[model samples]
Target: MQKVEKVTDKLPELGARFTLIIFLITIIMNWADKNLFSPKLNAILEDFGFAANETTPLGIIAALFMITTGIGMVIFGVIADRGQRKWITIICSFVYSILTILTYFTPNGIAGYWYLFFMRLVGGFGLGAVVPAIFSMIGDYASPDKRASTFSKFTVATIIGQMGGLALSSGFSEWRVGYLTVGLFEFVMAVLMIFIKEPKKGVSEEELHSVLVAGAEYQFKFKKEDIKILWNNKSNKWIILNFIDTIPGSMVAFVLFKYLDDYYNIKESDVLILMGVGILGGIFGAILFGYIGDQLFKKNKNARAIIAFFCNLAPVFSYMLLFLPLFNDLYVPDGVTFGELISYPEVQFLTIIVFISLFINQGNGPNWYSSVLDVNLPEHRSTMISVASFADLLGNALGPLIGSLVYQFISGRAAMITVAIFWFANSLFWIPVIRNIKADIENNKKILELRSNQLKPPDN
Candidate 1:
């Protein structure tokens, strides 16, 4: 057996703060793409000469974008494992940014919908590529002990991006302006990313600290056979399969505002205010749970998954409070601003419920992200994340179409109830993960330690 050399120097911090800021902004822009058109769906439909009730076209467009995004995750994930992640991210960002700008030029009529559809389909690939690259870099930057908290910040960026997209698109008279604005921001980020340094693989692992500090590289690279190794990991199996949660999560995401409008006669402006409050809850939940997960991780390796299980279940009850006829008498008067809306006793009560539901629902992202990093090898992290994200993107792709069908055939209320049930079911998959996580983490550490011992230090 090989042995690690004595550490002669401290392992350098790899521009973690700067890198995180850039990646966080990238994540925000990528997620914003998902919601850019959603808030102004009616306006887009009207511009395209479609009937007010026609939503299938929009659903189809959303589904196509998700499908392409899934493909990009898998493709870019593989490439990121073997190539320079920095350049891959830059190129993908440029691709999506250009396509987003093109959306601003869409002509009015049914043709414009097709044009928008194509742009989304192609742009989604760019969006998909960024997920694996950013997460892979994050795994290297964040120490094992702090991964959940770090990951939580990125998850918060996702929520912020979602709200930002909604606000930007709806704030304007022309929905296309939102896409243009988002595209410009993405382009600037891609340019700035050129100067951010990529961290050495596995630098954050305690097992590799001595090796890296002694001026040796963690030289293991991803290989084709590693796919089997990844699939065979027990924790990876649960993580990949646990993507069912996203289906209902996406269902609610695509339709929640529309549901409010149809069921409660809530106006778009009022829904935005409520959604803003929900975002605040989500941000708070992510940060709080991220701290809780990190604290618990110190005590038990299984704590992250355990927290995730309960958090997933919490939303079911909260959604019940929001969607049920309990608030039938609550109404927002015309042109109510945020202050006036909150002043209403019933609206204030509804806001509390929204905040709570979103707060708990947001817990799953940070913990899940940390869980993926904890189980996979450094060389395999990008590919594994991509594979896992593909599963998630698939759910996102199907969610809108399925939600539309359910709402059309059954009723809006039935669709929401269905979302709650699926959300509950997402919690069950975590049991297997909680059971297997400890062993998997141990196995990963052992591999890293072995690799660390084999690394050759640079000659003086």
Candidate 2:
């Protein structure tokens, strides 16, 4: 009988603790940048040419920012794959936080256009760089069964940071306060990053050679050839489409709130409340969906993709429920405005809306991210993630501009409905893609199980 080794049989729990702690620190920085712009986005729009139905350049700033982030992910994924993960996370933590806070320095108006755009773009790049590094760090050291739960813990911490930002932003009169808060959170994490240890990559028997290049000679260093191999792999095409799936959701989350503020005559203050509820919902949602995905996926490796593919239906319906204007006719009973809100009704409704939307959004994350990882070859997984991240960014950059332009041409009412239709369209895109995804995941699992016979025995 072959003596088989379990990859995680004797792993130290300390590694997991340090990884989670570092992950939380990273979330602090992420929360800071994400929230810094939150309170001020409307004010900046007002300073420019605010209107009841207007979409600000902030949408563009965010879209463009995500593009840079995608670019950073691609660049840093290659670097982290070849070099050190710890320092890469540290550098990105510093860059994203500092740049995000710098947005507050921009003078309001058209003058701030370039200023805000650059700050947002740079900050996005920093976030892009670090997220994959965090994933890589955890993946390198985590036991297979623990990966999703470990990942979820980091994601939940991120939700906590986001919740903190939303809560604080809801209180403040000035946008700078939110921006300063995110900056401080990130700056502190930057210091904590100095202590993390980079984990060594595992080399299994089937992966003794390259995942893409067959028998072609190569070292596992960053090179143009490695990227070329990544691009030529046709099996990855669906993964690229999965990235596009993220854009519509991100658009609705980041820009739709601003649209809601204007259309419903609700205060921006209440929008933060709505987002706070979203943050809370996302925290729970990450744990729930991630746990489900991990557990179901154990029995059937294709389970995650299948779940994600089906779960896409949830957002499509949620957006429709949210966008339908029949409810718009419902009147706000007197006493609710941005200020002097009677907590009785105002707080309750906003919380419901936010929690529902958060559920929709968070449900999409784990299935989508984990599905891609399940299918990819370990040697090429980092590259695949980078490409997918890039594709998602490109789609994200455009989703907002298209949504904003639709509103620009029509009213926010029309734009909301159109966004609903767009969400449905995006969900449909998954149908054809998942057929291929299921096959790949099944094949990968078969191969992994076959190789288990050759694994080294666990040291007892």
Candidate 3:
């Protein structure tokens, strides 16, 4: 392959910092857009003259949105691999923001339902495109050794965004205001993104650093044939297959609010507060596990997969504690403020369980992201992430649909027990990943070194 000459100067330290800030903000807004409507689903449905209990329409809408988002990720992941990622992300942000704001104008009745449904489906494209593009840039910007910690920041952002959206939409008297507000903020992020300069691919790789400093670019682009290369990689195969984890994870998440409401008689406001506490624990866990994964990764190439395996396994037990007869007697008293509710021994015990379960569960994100980046070539990173993310989307889409059926046929606890089994299965699947990661990393390094040699200028 002929070496491509570097076109722009290397990204400055200051510029890189700015870029990271913008990317984090954009991720937060994107996630908030996806989640804001969820907490207000009943309100939106009622506004369209549907019953509050009519979940079918909302379920279909959610499924379609995930389908569109997955399609967008595949399409834009290819573009992100071959084109300028910054512009792609900016355009996507703008597209989603506009659609989100337009949702405020939806009229009542069947017309309104169709409007909301189409808005979400079309809006998913923008939401999906940003992820692969941003992660691709992160792969280029973050040092290999510190990648888990860096990716953890994005994970934290996602949690905060989820919490923020739920809080805003549920707190507001009018749910449309939530969409309008988030849309305006996302638009501002798109404008701010205009200032970010795109980083050259593979700029952070140890093998290519010297060549990049000497003004050579890592110019590999994704081709249709490269799909075979992706499937051939052992680690990539495991990573993509890791979607099984998300299926039960999403099932548990989907029914959590309803379970609490039905079983514990907790109000929406109190549930939000409890969710906030759990999310805070999750944020702490991501940061802590991310740092730990990075340190362990310095010693063993398989450390991330190992950490992920245990993280997945540990959560199963905690979830059982929450769902099984262990917590059957607990109940939240009506009309108690959230602060007062936490003072109850039963509420406190349940809260602690939720916090711990979420804290451990969050460890999977950063390590999984770092492992994917480690096992792929720079040009292949976005496409690989898209494939993995689409698998995740599939699991998320199916989980709620399946969980709803299970909840109808059996008890809520039965549905949750199924979630635990799926989680255990997810943990077992990581064993193959642990076995394959070291060799994959070494193979990727060897390829980068060979490419770097070819890019080197001839000696005088």
Best by lDDT: 1
Position 186, candidate 2: lDDT: 75
Ten-residue region with minimum lDDT total, candidate 3: 1-10
Q: What Cα-based lDDT does every candidate model obtain? A: 0.84, 0.62, 0.82
lDDT sort, best first = 1, 3, 2
lDDT of 2 by residue, 220-296 (tens): 45566666645544446765766656556555545555675555555566666666656778778777877887788
TM-score of 3: 0.94
Tens-digit lDDT track of model 1 for 1-460: 3232222233224455666788898889888878876677778889999875677788888888998999999999989988888889999999999999888899999889889988998899998998999899888777787889988999899999989888887788899998998899999999988887777777777888756766797777899899899988999998998888888978877777778777666766777878899899999999999989999998999899998888898888977886555577766656666677667676777788889988998888899999999999999999999999998988888888788778777887788788878888888999999999999999998888788769978999
User: TM-score-based ranking, best first?
Assistant: 1, 3, 2
Off by over 4 Å in 3: 1-9, 12-14, 324-326, 331-333, 409-411, 457-460
* Minimal lDDT window, size 10, model 2: 209-218
Query: Which parts of model 1 have CA positions greater than 4 angstroms off?
Result: 1-14, 331-340
Q: What TM value does model 1 have?
A: 0.94
Residue 286, model 1: Cα distance from true site in angstroms: 0.7
Full-model lDDT, candidate 1:
0.84
CA deviation > 4 Å runs, candidate 2: 1-15, 35-39, 47-56, 161-165, 203-235, 323-326, 333-357, 438-460
Q: Mind giving the per-residue lDDT tens digits that candidate 3 earns over 8-81?
A: 34674447777788788888877676566556656777888887556556667776787788889889999999
lDDT of 1 at 345: 71
